[model samples]
Target: MATQNEVIFRLARSSRSVPRARALAHAVLSSWGVSQGTLEAAELVLSELVTNALRVRVPSDRQVGVRIARSLEDGLLRLEVSDAGSGRPEVRVPEDDETGGRGLLLVEALAHRWGVEERTGGIGKTVWAELKAPDIVAEPVGREVAAVLVRPGQWVRVWGEWRAVRTVDTGPYAAGGLAVVLGLDDGSALRVNAAEPLTVWNGGSSSAREGGEDEPG
Candidate 1:
């Protein structure tokens, strides 16, 4: 169910509606205090979904619908674009020369999950995508650890032991703006909020970048 934070808009079937939908998404997410990464991904996903909705052959009197909802409890932000068209969207492999056919591909790559469903009490379907909220950890004040930024390959103390940051997931609905998967030395793993005020250590560095599952520690 959508919370009180959800925003819905009726968009005209014109190219200009894409930017309008994106602007609405940005404003709503910003008011909710989402992280930069979350805002960027949500806007892109919104643009793609709206663009596709506009491309469908709907009646001139029918307007596309855009809905943005945030689940702070679940740490997720969902974007939904509804159109009167009757087709389901699918991800396709675009040829090297294709300028289009990659919208859903980008949506698939960026969204944590995405799909289409018939609109409630409506004649068409709503294409939706969910983005996991990013964890935004504020720097501790007046301490050396305050300067320690958490990213992939950074060593931070977890449960009194040092663990490597395996991956960072920042999408809407994530608590404190981000979640970090920590690599344990014993070949196990753990997940924690990056915003948690924990001590970070400068244990020797590795070349791992953010966004992927790490090998057993």
Candidate 2:
């Protein structure tokens, strides 16, 4: 009964402020009478986006922008977080002891579609996730497909069954696309169409790497 629309907000980047983003989502979608399941999915996606923005992007005096919108073309709702950092996000299969890599994985699993792109006229990236209405029929889950863009000559490790181990680099290009990797711990490895080989590098501090670079190949 209600028309699809968009809502946008800007706020400071802080772990403490993450809940505000979720509250805004619940408040705006309440008018649409979205189901509990849809609300949960929306909240989860919002949390992932905001968390990544706060953790990965260096907070500045300027506020991070959060945008909630509906796509009339597909009848889908999208949640986006844009920050002032040049980093991008990768959906990585984290180790059992790793404390942080799972956020993007949850986003990938819960949202119908999610992605990141460079922001215009700034040194930042905009991460987004989309979901259809709860009443909409769900799509069958199949082999997972993850697109990973690795820089040329950068090394990446693929975690999976011993027989399927792979290492690749993009040679001369700093960006690789659709590179596949698996979560050996969870027994789920999506098949990726590797457009370029990944370059390998020594393990470094957790906070040093930016964007999707932290992900396993």
Candidate 3:
């Protein structure tokens, strides 16, 4: 059994990358047997984080980094968006007349757990969220992400739906106890340690602005 688990993408800093990233996540997660409810939530989380990262002002040469990994502790799905930009993300109350600013609010609500941190080995920061991924039992006809038996051109019953395999390749091992596959493209994934809980911006009872920010993903 190949244990390498993770999918990493270095996307160009553009508004178009937002939809593309979400699509990639949906395809990969679906192929991995992620439940529909959890899959929807995960895509929203990814969208918010990626959208926010693109809003940050960074050097033209820099790109936004996205990572998707499952937690080994309990198969929780982790989503991370990192950028070489400025300014820490804060949850603030929006004006009553304001049209937008509710991103973090929704993130705090949808994600089972979410947070931000100083980017490791990078300039700015990374915003991440972890969604609960219920363990899927192996079915005779259906398949779980075994990383070996599952290959391109196979139709496997994922979670509860049937999906076609596209590509599968080993990736990098993320430090911090994550068995990530480096540079592994779509159709590849790995598990990681359940990361630290919400830290950077508190989502406890009271948030900074309380009311919230962003249109969200």
Query: Global CA lDDT of candidate 2, please?
Result: 0.58
* Residue range with the least summed lDDT across 10 consecutive positions in model 2: 160-169
Candidate 2, residues 145-211, lDDT tens digits: the string is 2235532222233431111123322223225543454222122343445542432332223221222
Instruction: Give the candidates in order of TM-score, highest first.
Output: 3, 1, 2
Distance from true location, Cα of 90 in model 3, Å: 1.1
C-alpha positional error of residue 36 in candidate 1 after TM-score superposition, expressed in Å: 0.6
**Would you list the rank order by lDDT, best first?**
1, 3, 2
Q: 1 or 3: which has the higher lDDT?
A: 1
Model 1, 91-172: lDDT tens digits are 9998999889999999999999999999899799999999998542222211123212555555454443334555444433
Model 2, position 63, has a per-residue lDDT of 56
Q: Give the best candidate by lDDT.
A: 1
What lDDT does each candidate get?
0.65, 0.58, 0.59
**Cα-lDDT of candidate 3:** 0.59
lDDT, residue 87, model 3: 76
Give the CA lDDT, 0 to 100, for residue 125 in model 3. 89
The root-mean-square deviation over C-alpha atoms between each candidate and the true structure, in angstroms, is: 18.3, 18.8, 14.1
